[model samples]
Target: MTEGRPLRADARRNRERVLAAAREAFAAEGISVPLDEIARRAGVGPGTVYRHFPTKEALFHAAIVDNIERLTDYARELATAADPVHAFFGFLDHWVAEGAVKRDLAEAIGSDHALELSSPVKGMLDSIETLLHRAQRSGGVRPDIDLDDLLRALKGTFLVTHIPTITDAQRRRTFAIVFDGLRVR
Candidate 1:
């Protein structure tokens, strides 16, 4: 029903604006922000937003996929750090802190069946697993822990620290306590 060609310059600009607005809105207000508000923020009409993203779910999924890809890239970069243990824990700390404000995004990814199967998500997990294995082999992490343990610890940490009433200091303290448990005795 549509031509399979590159978008025109104006159309491409409009699409980029829409995605940028959507990312900001989703980060500040979660995925519940109205499409019209996103369109207004992008200086585009609602029809233009709809033309670029057929539904809010589609837009949110795109954002999540984009985030996963970026995180995977970051993990890949961290993988080459001189200290494997520091690299692993640094990645974990950064991930949990970033995810603290993106609780809605976490919930959406957890619930979305399609997103769970996405290659970016899988790549992120694999990268994490490799990091964990490297740290363990270096005797920095406890040998008994595996990738699943690390994931569960991060999920638990995020769930516990992401509450609105919790102060930043409290979150850091809690994360420190949990993270300490992962180190070799």
Candidate 2:
């Protein structure tokens, strides 16, 4: 889609289907899931998957960008919600939950490919920052905190979620601690 002027309606639909399938497949089965399996899951021919994403790295990069774009959009919506504090904390909850699932895909793609994701990651961080500022203005979040600090804490939380056998209660407690620290006491 990025190579052309624009994708036609049917072509756009095909690409989206492929991406949705790829995201689920990669997240569930890792990048080792064959393109043929992705196409089968998408209900499209294998050639269609290649047409949209020529290589595994290309497809993975697209999938990761697509996920970030979606989260950014969601965060932007929540930023203007009636309860800024809830929106901020709720976004963090959603983000961490998503990271727990997506960790496999990121690991399968390897650290080398992750370096190309700066742009979309920046957009995600900016959306979080907007929500943070809104929450702070509402006197729910700590005024002294900044996006950098929040990002560091979020990264650490994501890492914690990578623990091989962490129970759900442990995960919740970990997040509760982070949330408690960020909230204005």
Candidate 3:
């Protein structure tokens, strides 16, 4: 997984499998998912995972970055959609739905750490701001809200849904309330 260096075909496949497994595992179970578990999920040996990612931090960061990059890209794409109101609310719904169960995603962007405020995260924030501004201008979202407000609301939604005992019905109800608060009417 070295930069600019090509891996052998089998090695590359193994790496890809490991990364996919890591992403899915982290998304579903958080960073605490064991390397061995990831290996089993990938159908590779634990040594293969270690070979590609020497440390859990390395694998975790890579998976988190990949997920964040994907989310940012999706938001940027939606920024140009014909309906900003739909795009903005749909994106919020997507995050609330996925982030509720994605512990690693919640932890990655939910923090105030140095890395959390840098390029990757900033890119996502910019996209969200674009959608938020467009929606506000269209009178679909409350004009009083800012990026920080929306982000806080998103974080709160993620946290509340992460409660182990929260039912799916309750989670949906919670997000319905939060989303209603964000809407203009």
For TM-score, the strongest prediction is 1
lDDT computed for candidate 1: 0.79
For residues 1-185, write the lDDT of model 1, one tens digit per residue.
14698898999899889888888787656677899999999999999988978888777667677777877888999998889999999988777667767664454434444655677778888898888888999999999988767766776776677677899889899889888999998
lDDT digits (tens) for residues 6-111 of candidate 3:
8999999999899899989988887778999999999999999998998886788777786688889989999999999999989987877668778877766656
Arranged by TM-score, best first: 1, 3, 2
Model 1, residue 50: C-alpha shift (Å): 2.9
In angstroms, give how far residue 184 of model 1 lies from its true place. Answer: 3.4
TM-scores of all predicted structures: 0.78, 0.66, 0.77
**C-alpha RMSD values across all candidates:** 3.0, 4.7, 3.0
Give per-residue lDDT, candidate 1, residue 48. Answer: 95
The candidate, 1 or 2, that scores higher on TM-score is: 1
**Cα lDDT, all candidates:** 0.79, 0.80, 0.85
